[model samples]
Target: MLYSKQKVAKAVLVLIFFTVVLIGITLVSLNNGRNGTRSLRSFVSEDTSTSPESIDEALQYFIYGAKYLLAAVKSTVSDNSANITAVSHSITVVKDRMQMLLSEFEHHLHRTEILSFLSLPVINNHNFSYIYNREDICSKKAVKLVFVVPSAPGNVEKRQTVRKGSRGDYVRKNANNTILLFFLGKPSPGSNYLSLQTKIDEEVKEFGDIIQADFEDVYSNNRLKSVSMLRWISTYCSTAKFVIRADDDVNITTVEVVSALERAAETLSNFIIGHKLIADRPSRNVKNKYYLSKKEYPPPTFPPYLLGGLLVYPVSTAKLLYQAALRVKPIWLEDVYITGICATKVYIPILSDPGVVFQHRKS
Candidate 1:
């Protein structure tokens, strides 16, 4: 007998939940066990013959948890009036360590690379030895896929409803008609906040594929964002002609973005609309996480920055941007400094729509 599609999806959700839980327990047990803070014998009664599938599942969960934990640490580390020098230095050390772990766990799965061939990538002129996949990067015109990283199955499904079938792929009436808002990654389990994130991610699935993708690193959270982003750019850009990148917190009208982008699809190199700022402060300073040393960027105002909250770039631009980001030093704030710098260096202008973009800076 064949099961209904709903049943199948539900079963998959259950499997994932248990898998994430067991993995979390096991990793916690092992580490705590070694330190003698907690005993591991009690939790080791389960089957030891773990298969590649099980290990892979566990590792992914470990990585997801680490990402959340890292965000938690960075967000909570410094006090309100902390000195920029000391806080900045501490953050730098943590960022360096996180980048190391992220570097170590590079390829858990071929992610963003899955859909890269759409637009013709503009050549990168950075100081580092950057390799451009001329043949595959941004060669395609359009493609379809779901974004699964931001939440759980049920939540992802809801987001898909908002994103999918709403305005139909591309917003404006134009040729190159497909643009998908793909959301991916894992959400923390059994938490009210994560539950909300999962719900939002499900809604995003309607827009594309929300695969249960994760990077396999338990020690560092930066590794997950860094790793997941690398995966997304590598695999996803190949199929999309133009792409939209966003965080779950912000409000995004994909249809409006498509309409706005389509208007300038002919003249623009790349577009990133939203309130953009290039922070002049130092990121290492615990007081201000959105820090960039004045020496690195001397001007009081940002050098044509974009609000990392929402962005729309040609697939080629995404590929080029990610590649350029990899070669540069990883900063504390991932989206702004890394993406803004990469885009600015290569002259990939962050397109903006003043009407839609909103930014509130810390005074």
Candidate 2:
């Protein structure tokens, strides 16, 4: 179980900590001669007289040395705090690689148990004809942002709310440079699909911001929705400097996203930033909507992924992810498949940005 692994990891970390402490003390001792202090070797060698004062002096020297050693370690740790953080980040990257390898092995081992679970028929074909696409939105000028929102066809009210909100208004006013498009698939079978499609057509005609694809709008096809968005961006919005994949229910400020992008403009290559989810395991409870059977996903923990609520990356990163998505086995969990698996495949570095806010709408 994961608990045993955590216990072993903690033990290793403790061992490493003690090893560092010993090394610090050794370096401090070796530098005593250069710093005009009595070395421990000299203190022992010179003080050979069997007087009680000599013994007391030796004891006091050792006490002083202990204090000095502690101070050196503390100073070293403090001075190199940034380096320590980088080391921790490197460890996290290594952990992600290990988990990815484990997941791959498990997938191969149980390939036959699942029924076309990872197949990407929609992605491979690349025949995503837009029922209502704003292909000309970014045609005339350079686009600064392409905000992609994936929504269900039934959530018409949600779409309108987002449009009337501040974020949508920002996109609407900056239509020449910024764009917001809703990506959707065909309506579900239980709903009035034709009627809903009619309403969507009307909405798109009025607002010119919908990109309906040629697939079913079901929970299992969530990854396909992302694939479609990427494909669209690659085909039509390649000039965009940045792209965001957010959910319809999530409230995100466009101005804040633009500001974050501004701060990260210098190092935009191979970059993806979002709220990170590390060591999250799939739910096993059947009653839970996010449940996954052992046969579907054999790993104990998922690879680190960004939450599906909001994701920000450059257009170049999106292209790389789309290319990787075609080869990597698809998963129903869109966030894990795109941000975790595909991003890892292409060696795109995902930065954890705590400032990306997500306020989910109530049901």
Candidate 3:
């Protein structure tokens, strides 16, 4: 077969064009491959129960991996100035996209993780903290404000002394100074609460300038119980910078709580009083928890609600958190519901300060 030089040249050009096209497609495929692997690792790593703290840790890991991967791509493009520089540059572009996607995922994981830990811990009968070290992290700093969560026991047999004060209100701590709130909930019979309510009434009368509310029947669902309480608190602290939210039954010396709250003024509000909650195997069906119901919440796990009784949230943070809590469906996990579902949404940091112990086990 005899072919002209021109014809041979034309055939060669066509062949070269097809070859380049094939190479381009292959490189694109390789870039997509890198992205797929990174995406899988970034979003779907493993199946395990994630606590808020663990979620934060995972975000850190994702961030670190992303940065490392990007650096590797950059180095490949910069250092390898060889025949494959074009391919390397393409690879780097793909790598950057993967990192960006992963970072977004990291943020999402953090949000969910925080909510996972928010179900309010039931600290009614048993104690979560033993002999607590009172002033560990929150020693005397400046003593900004001491906030109290007013707990009303249904039967107030033992609450005679607390009830006999000037105002006969739920917030009978010290009205003359500092801040106070009537965190209304189901009252218990053991604390002589009827009389205590009387005392609280008097206390309110004396220093009525205190911060307080009476949500005695707000929490029929645990999902919004802590949130309801927090909203109750935030309404009072409109001007105050810092706040301390604590339980009535739990033993916390006013002087001590106030001192600690001052130190934490600079730290994040929307903080929960933390103790190692003795987590028994909760009912496999999230609905098994009394606070949880399938109608409002169909999910199997509770939102990260802190124990409803005690916590400290800054006024501004509390407002944002309460709004977020309203947005989420009720999950019946009281504490986690507030911290993870509500507070976590704003990217507000939730912290546990020393001296502000939880589960102190006392009546």
Best by the lDDT measure? 2
lDDT minimum window of 10 residues, candidate 3: 125-134
Candidate rank order under lDDT: 2, 3, 1
In model 3, which runs have C-alpha deviations exceeding 4 angstroms?
1-143, 153-177, 185-229, 253-264, 267-273, 276-291, 294-296, 303-305, 359-363
Q: What TM-score would you give candidate 1 relative to the actual structure?
A: 0.43
TM-score of each: 0.43, 0.66, 0.45
lDDT for model 3, on a 0 to 1 scale? 0.46
What C-alpha lDDT values do all the predictions have?
0.44, 0.68, 0.46
Local accuracy of candidate 2 as per-residue lDDT tens digits, 179-268: 778999989776587799899988888888899998888998898999999989988888888887779898887678767665554433
Tens digits of per-residue lDDT for model 3, 1-363: 112335434533443344334433534344556543444233334455753354345446545655675665565556544434657666654554444344334434455554554444423211112111122212323333545454443323223322333223323444423434334443334456576556555644664422223333334533333554455444434555555665545544445545565544432233444432323223446555354455655555544445555566556666666656655554555666566555556555444445665444334
Prediction 1 global C-alpha lDDT? 0.44
Looking at model 1, report the run of 10 residues with the lowest lDDT sum.
Answer: 125-134
Off by over 4 Å in 1: 1-161, 164-182, 187-208, 216-237, 278-280, 283-303, 355-363
Clashes per candidate (backbone, < 3 Å): 59, 0, 60
Which candidate number would show the highest TM-score if scored against the true structure? Answer: 2
